[model samples]
Target: MYRVLIVDDEPMILKGLTVFLQQSGVSIASIRSASNGEGALAAIREELPDFVFTDIRMPVMDGLALCAQIAEMDQKVQTVVISGYDDFTYAQTCISYGVKEYLLKPISKPDLQDTLRKLIQRAEAAKPASAYLSVAKMDEWMAEIEQAIYYMNQEQVTQLLHTWEQEIATYHMQDEQRIEMLQEFHVLLMKKLKARDVNIELRPLLELKQGMSFHTVYQQFTGSIQDTLDSLYRRRKGKLKDPIEEVKIYIEQNLGSEVSLEEAADLLGLHPNYFSVMFKQMTGETFVQYRTKRRMEYAKRMLGEERYRITDISYAVGYADHSNFTKTFKKYEGISPSEYRQKMGI
Candidate 1:
């Protein structure tokens, strides 16, 4: 369906054309009427009708001038000039404005139908092939790409990209759609990588200069993704140090002080969630559990010294209150600090 504009100075002709267009077996979104070329220009700017039918001998701006202005505004607008005169000069002038349809005043049904058919075909051809493709269906590829990149598996990433190309080829997508899909895929990759690291530098798939084939553009796109994966892999591998060792040393040095996982991660220049996950995976314990076990071990060693009171040992081991320390010690050792002291004969 398409919007159409009917321009004619006569009221009866405008109404007649509007009614005839409705019954012409041509489906249209609307039939807008304008008494002159000036009114038609205003209507065109308001909603840019897909087709315009104008009379050649209209007042306040004629049909030839209207077609010229319409072509200047948007050449894609299909113009059909309805002329009262069958003069060759008028026909040539309309042709100069790229108006292909020039119908005599008493229009026939077959000519109008042929004009509508040609306009519809032109509109369909102008649309991008990607407009008909569902991009959300590629979510599976995005998920696999994210996981493969997270694990720094370049070979897996390469293989997955190959599979994606094969799938697109199997679907027999047009070159324009293939290009559009690559652009969309780049956007998805950027979002996933930015979530992992904000400072990650990313660029578009290709410069897309003139005359580049779909094959060349696609090759550049795949190469760019693989290069990005390699770059990310190197950055992560450089930080492959076991961070647990550093965290343990810090815990031993400041066992008497309060600390949060967020602060610790910040000190190591890592996101809290990321650091927390990596910490647990490497040490087999949460930060609090590891700290508690180490603190209890030190507290037991302090019990060997008779001079330092249990309350003093509590404060030394990061417990500001003795009762809280006693509770935690009981939970970890299955007995109170005093019972542990007595059992050890301290």
Candidate 2:
């Protein structure tokens, strides 16, 4: 569902409009009111709604200033202005600030529905490509780019080209600025690729015509780089660590709780079989083995204190049953909790 925010001085208008929009099939994710521009700015900073509707003549901050602030935070947000009259000059200013549409004070239900439908349709269509550009892929891609900058590998150039192709196919970008950006990226890649001990390859330089602007050329190929990179990262969601490291950390932190291999794998977003194999490959020990080893270490420390009962120590380090803890401890440490405490001279 698309999240939309409304900012206006009129309380009745806010509530009536919110009710109308909600009943029209749009989930009014949040309906916030701001008597002035400062309040709207605070709300926008706090929530960052997908779509924002506000009046042009709010006190303290006004719609124009709010548009500027939102633009700084996220240029993609769709801003719609609400005004009492057809003020062309004011509309021009809002348009310059990237406002999508302006609605009169008495907003018709049909107009709101049409505008909302267009926004939802656009978002739904973009969701699939967005999913593919997941956070993991973006981090990997950024690493590859940094690697290319460091090692100047032709492979990085090849990989970058592949990324551009994927993003271009997904996003409908048809702007001259985008074209110029792509051209600049190509030139940069080519320059970096051919760097031989701080000297450029004369052949590539000669290929550039005398009339061609290097900056414009470079921009043409790199224009889509930012959008593509963004999509790639958003799809992956977050940085990924070694699956074994994740499991080890979780086990150590939750030592007093029962943990299964399947649960560990699920937390790491991996299948149980794959995570089991991968964990062993990376750590050279099964999940249970490492968990047991750590628990044994904690048990030994607790036993040294001698103030707590054996059963207390058993549950302290994640064992639910005292008998199971004693059995495992004896099997791994060659003594029961009681004997271990005695040896520690408690």
Candidate 3:
């Protein structure tokens, strides 16, 4: 049984196509509809369908764009373009986006049936790969993937995914466990990136297991994570190292002065908002938190020296007001500066 989505702006057309498909003498497990390309693509991302019957020139997103984005999103589904125009250019363009068939608007019953016949036939002929590895090996591979992603080890991640791409074909697990393993891969990626404090928005790549080939799922799953990791790697290699690293250096050089997020952002050519978010993500701390801690560490070093008075030490560390410094330092160290000094026996 195959799943299908019918995309059209006209309610009548949607209903008519649904009726025609049901009567086409094809084995369909489910039939769904969407008024526009945007909704259709969203549906596809959430749950991939085996076939898409889309009318051209719909509002919000056109049929051409729907097919184009589907290609970019890296999911394979046989698409039949249904349009009133009969424009050779439109048909040619949709074909370029990998549309499997082009049907006229008042879709002929025989044409629809033939399209279904061919699609199902092609799908059945392309045998999906099965994993023969023991469940323990599968678990170990996923664990290695998790560790590599957690540490942002790109080389290790690439090598692991490369192996997975080949090994994914041999999985012979039952349907339920197969689906669960894919879902676990998705979750593991989320957890590992979260551990690095890098926020990534991802659609679970392996949504429906029944229709997608094992290699298809593996490629999409690995491709998405690699894309995200590559993006992060690019940012780290941008201009001159990550922005937060440059900002940390500036903070270190001017430990006795105010550190401005706006100034740091200007230096890095990033908006303050973007810089702030990036800083928090890369360092796992707010600027104020890190600066205060850095200043206190410097102040503590000066306090341990007999040559520097506590008040002068505070001034040297960028605190002009001695009382204010004591307040902030006590908050950080849970003790007054004098007490800390006495404890240090300086």
Please give each candidate's TM-score. 0.46, 0.37, 0.38
Clashing pairs in 3: 130-169, 130-170, 130-171, 131-170, 131-171, 131-172, 132-170
lDDT to native, each model: 0.78, 0.65, 0.75
Strongest candidate by lDDT: 1
lDDT of 3 at 135: 34
**Whole-model lDDT, model 1:** 0.78
TM-score of 2: 0.37
For residues 1-346, write the lDDT of model 3, one tens digit per residue: 5689999999999998897776444446789899999999888977789899998989999999999988786665888889999799997898799887898978766677677767776666554535333433554675687656534688899898888756654557754555456666576556544533434434457456466665566677777777776665665563325447778889988888987887887776656655676687678898888888889998888888888999888888788998999999999999999999999997
Clashes of each: 0, 28, 7
Give one digit per residue, the lDDT tens place, for model 1 in 191-248.
6566545545455775677656677877887777777766766877745334568788
Off by over 4 Å in 1: 1-144, 209-215, 233-256, 267-316
Q: What ranking emerges by lDDT with the best candidate at the front?
A: 1, 3, 2
Judge candidate 3 at residue 212 and give its lDDT. Answer: 65
